[model samples]
Target: MKGIVLENKILNDKYGIICIKSDEFAQNAAPGQFLMIRPQPYDYIYDPLLRRPLGICDINEKKGTFSLLYMIVGKGTKLLSKIKKKTELSFSEPLGTGFNLTTDKKVAIIGGGVGIAPMTFLSKILHENNEVDVFYGGAEEKDILLTHIFEEYSNNLIIATEDGSIGHKGFITEVFENSLKFNNYDKIFACGPKPMLKAVYDIIDIEKIEFEVSLEERMACGIGACLGCIISTIGTDPNSNSQKRCCVEGPVFNGKEIIWETVCKE
Candidate 1:
């Protein structure tokens, strides 16, 4: 499908938000699904042949717009950063399975840096019927972008910075740990650096809390065909004792089923 870039600007020194006009895509998009974006502006097509995968940050059905939040990393994203208003781009959207929004109404969704992007839509839909708490962290003040959006959708939006420049002066993980001491979350979902997701899983694994985590990987083909984004899984599947493509079968997966150390090992 095709969409027009309505807004594209920096969130901070590290991140940018790109909003697009696409009614059909926005109406059908599910939380955690991504769009393979290929910028085709001013005869610059095919320079970066592979489209980058970005999570759908938000959707406004009435306005005919859907937004993608991205970090300005690498050559592909740098080109994406240059997109101006009204420029049309190619997209392969609503791809892969999104977060499991069907259960555990009282949910804790934790995100860090660019990882916070995907949590927006998930929080929005879940907020309508569930108690949603969002915890976010960054290296410094600038990295802690988009607090207001999360605040709008969450019952409680907790902020943390490692530099102590903002809310809690520690890892978002520390806040998560302390929160679990008293407040019992029915379910937990996390996206960010793998280490953060692993921490969330470790703390609650013993208690048997349900959790789903969205992953990141490099994909040649966003669908399963290319197999460029395979990662090991502990769960029983064809990839059980083997590996699963992060582009399919997951971008979201059972937290308890992932062998954190082995799968995350470099």
Candidate 2:
């Protein structure tokens, strides 16, 4: 359906936040789910014809609005940044599987860079009924987008920046690992670059903790039609693996189910 752009705030040279007024999207959006939006300001100017997949960053059900945090990665997203307020953009229904929400347990939420977008809503929902700890990391201070918002929804907000511009001086994973040693978290949810997810996968004790990771991929068709967003996952037989569409089967999956080597290689 078509959604009107309520606001498009550019965070920096690299990142921006766009809010859209879509009652259908806001009411239905779940953490980790994404929507595909065409970037052009007008439907006819379709130079970048394909719809860009953006994670559902925040939702205001009563206000009938949803936000997307995106990076200026290519022509599509660059155009997305220039979209004006009140402009109507074409958006797909909220797509992909969202994180499974569980309550009454200690939970760890990890995010890095723009990957932090989807975690906000998840943290908000989880914090209401669970002890939530959020670990956010970025390459620099500019990479940290919405800490104030995260703080409102988490019991503890831990931050790290590689250039020592923010909270911790090292990788966010390092802080996460340290926290894991002290906290017996019952569940964990993460979304970041693949290497960060792999690093997280390596540190967590999967047998003792349930962990899920939201993956990032380039998609041609946000629905399952195109086979462009396929990823490898473990099959019933250890020697083989099965393929899954990132746009449909998941953007969220158990960390254990992913074949890390394949993800790292891609």
TM-score of each: 0.94, 0.98
lDDT of 2 by residue, 57-130 (tens): 99999999999999998999999999999999889999999999988999999999999999998998998899
Model 1, 48-100: lDDT tens per residue? 88888999899998998999988888888888888899998888868888998
lDDT of 2 at 239: 84
Regions of candidate 2 where Cα sits further than 4 Å from its true position: none
How many pairs collide in each candidate, listed in order? 0, 0
- Each prediction's whole-model lDDT (CA): 0.85, 0.93
Q: Worst 10-residue stretch by lDDT in candidate 1?
A: 39-48
